[model samples]
Target: MSAEQTQASGVVGVLESVGRKSLGLFEEIGRFFFILHATVYWTFRRPFDGKEWLRQMVRVGVDSLPVVGLTSMFTGMVLALQTYRGFERFHAEGFVASVVSLSLTRELAPVLASLMIAGRVGSSLAAELGTMRVTEQIDALYAMATEPIQYLVVPRVGATTVMLPPLVAIANGLGIFGGYAISVALMGANPVTYWEKTFQYLDLNDVSSGLIKAAVFGLILSVTGCSKGFFTTGGAEGVGRATTSAVVMGSVVILVSDFFLTKILF
Candidate 1:
């Protein structure tokens, strides 16, 4: 074949590969939406497993508080320090509280807390379900006429969806306090001024907006993790892959969705 023809063929091959990958990505997205739909449908069905739901709530919510709190506290402190430094140049140090509080309640608290949960809880859920998949436990449930989506996925999705708002709320408070401690105690900003400005620009809408974002993030993480787990193949290697994919996909969705959510909420 002529060199020109060969180069044209290679270019065509590259285009074909790209097309295939793009199709595969869309297929995966479709599957994820289907799984989310199934989970929501199963959630409201009869014969509810309140015990399992509560157990998942404890696992996903209660167990996640420490990491979320630590992350929020440190984030707020660092944000306050940075904002104070910048504002000091303009002699607007008092605005540190407003910035810290607004940033935490409107963006950082929900995003960071959800990312932490995605890393910790999402990976764990994927691993657990992946292990069950490889071990045939999930198949066993099917054999017994039990729907895995209802028995397994619904409780988890419901728990995370219900619990994340409160977690974000707690993280918001901790983050604000962290900023307060840094601005007032460490940076020598006036305590009264800090407290006043912290709430000056903050209102119910800001706090509720963050909580709303957290709820959406919870749905995305749980659904993605569960879908990855449910579709796991191979064996131990597959379980590991699913776990990693869950965290990566969860984090990505959280960030991507955050922008649209913020635009809508704002």
Candidate 2:
């Protein structure tokens, strides 16, 4: 082929690839909405399994406590330590408590806790559902006159949505406490001053905003995980891919949505 023709064909190939990928992304987005519709439909029409909802709550919330708590606590400690050093240089050390409290309740707690749950519970949901999809277990449910979306997806999504707010609330407390411990016990800041400073400018709005974000993040994780697993193919390999995708997508959506939620709430 002529050089000019070859270059033209290469350009066309690149454009085609880009177009194909864009189309694929949109197609997947459409599938997500379809799944959402099915879930909503089943949710209102259900026999309503309380056992599954509670089980998933334990799995997504209770099982995740230690990891989320540790992450939030250390984050607060590091934040306090860093801010104390910086603020001390300017003789504004008192603001450290306020900064730590605001930062934790407004941003860090929900984001960090959600990210932890995405890694743990999101992957677990995806892996479990993907395995069922591959092993014909989900199909068997259909064959047995059970609607899989009702039997499976609603409970998970509902439980996560309900539990995440409380989880983030606990995380907020632990994180704030960690900051207090670091400032007062470790660095010898006055305990009374620290507590006062922490709550002085803080109010319900800050904490409530984070909890709202947490609930949204939970919905995102459950929906993403369930969708990925429900549509999984290619056997074990697909299951692994679905699990990884669930975690990655859940984390990314949580972060992206956090920015928008912060703007709206604050």
Candidate 3:
């Protein structure tokens, strides 16, 4: 082939490969959502494992608090600082509290919390289940007259869905406090005025929308992790890949879904 023709063919091949990978990614994402919806449907169908659900709930929600709180605190502080500086230039510094609270309650707190959970809980779920699948424990369960999906997947998904929103709400509160502290102590914001402005601008919709987003994000994490793990083949290498994919895909899904939710809701 001529040199230029060869180069053009190679470039086209590269673009085609990229397109194929992108299509595969979107397909995996679609499957992830479908599995999540199915799991949620199954979760409400029959009696749940109360003890297992309780334990998973505590692990996912209560145990996640410290990390979530720490993340939210710093996020709120940074938001206040950056926003305050911009508003200060316009002599609208008093709007800092409103800005901080509205942003956190509407998006940041829930989205960040969900991403953190996906990194922590989602990876773990994938690894654990992938390990079981590799070790043949999942197969054993299937042979024993036990349903792996019901016992393992359902409780985990149920726990995440039930737990995440409340955790996000808690994160929102902590984030607000963090903003309040930074504004009053560092920025010289008047405490009374700050609270007044925050209250004036805050509404139930902001909080409710954020919580709803949290629930959706939780489902995404749980389902993607579980689906990847459940279908995992090979051995340790496969499990490792699933774990990595779960976290990365779960985070991407959260960000994408967050945008669409925001657009639809607000």
Candidate 3 lDDT by residue in tens digits, 1-266:
69999999999999999999999878786777667666767777665689999999999999999999999999999999999999999899989999999999999999999999999999999999999999999999989977788889999988999999999999998998999999999999999999898879999999999999999889889988998898888999999999999999889989998999999988
Structural similarity to truth (TM-score) of each candidate:
0.97, 0.97, 0.91
Summarize candidate 2's per-residue lDDT along 1-266 as a digit string, tens digits: 59999999999999999999999788767766777789889988859898998998998889889999999999999999999999999899999999999999999999999899888888988999999999999999999999999999989888888899999999999999999999998888999999999999999999999899999998888888888899999999999999999999889888998889888999
* Worst ten in a row by lDDT for model 3: 39-48
Q: What local lDDT score does residue 154 receive in model 1, on the 0 to 100 scale?
A: 96
Stretches of candidate 2 exceeding 4 Å from the true structure? none
TM-score of 1: 0.97
Q: In candidate 3, residue 206 scores what lDDT? A: 92
Root-mean-square deviation of every model: 1.0, 1.0, 2.3
* Model 1 residue pairs with clashes: none
Q: Rate the local accuracy (lDDT) of all candidates.
A: 0.95, 0.91, 0.91
> In candidate 3, residue 107 scores what lDDT?
90
What tens-digit string does per-residue lDDT give for candidate 1 at 117-209?
Answer: 999989988999999999999999999999999999999989999999999999999999999999989999999989999999998999999
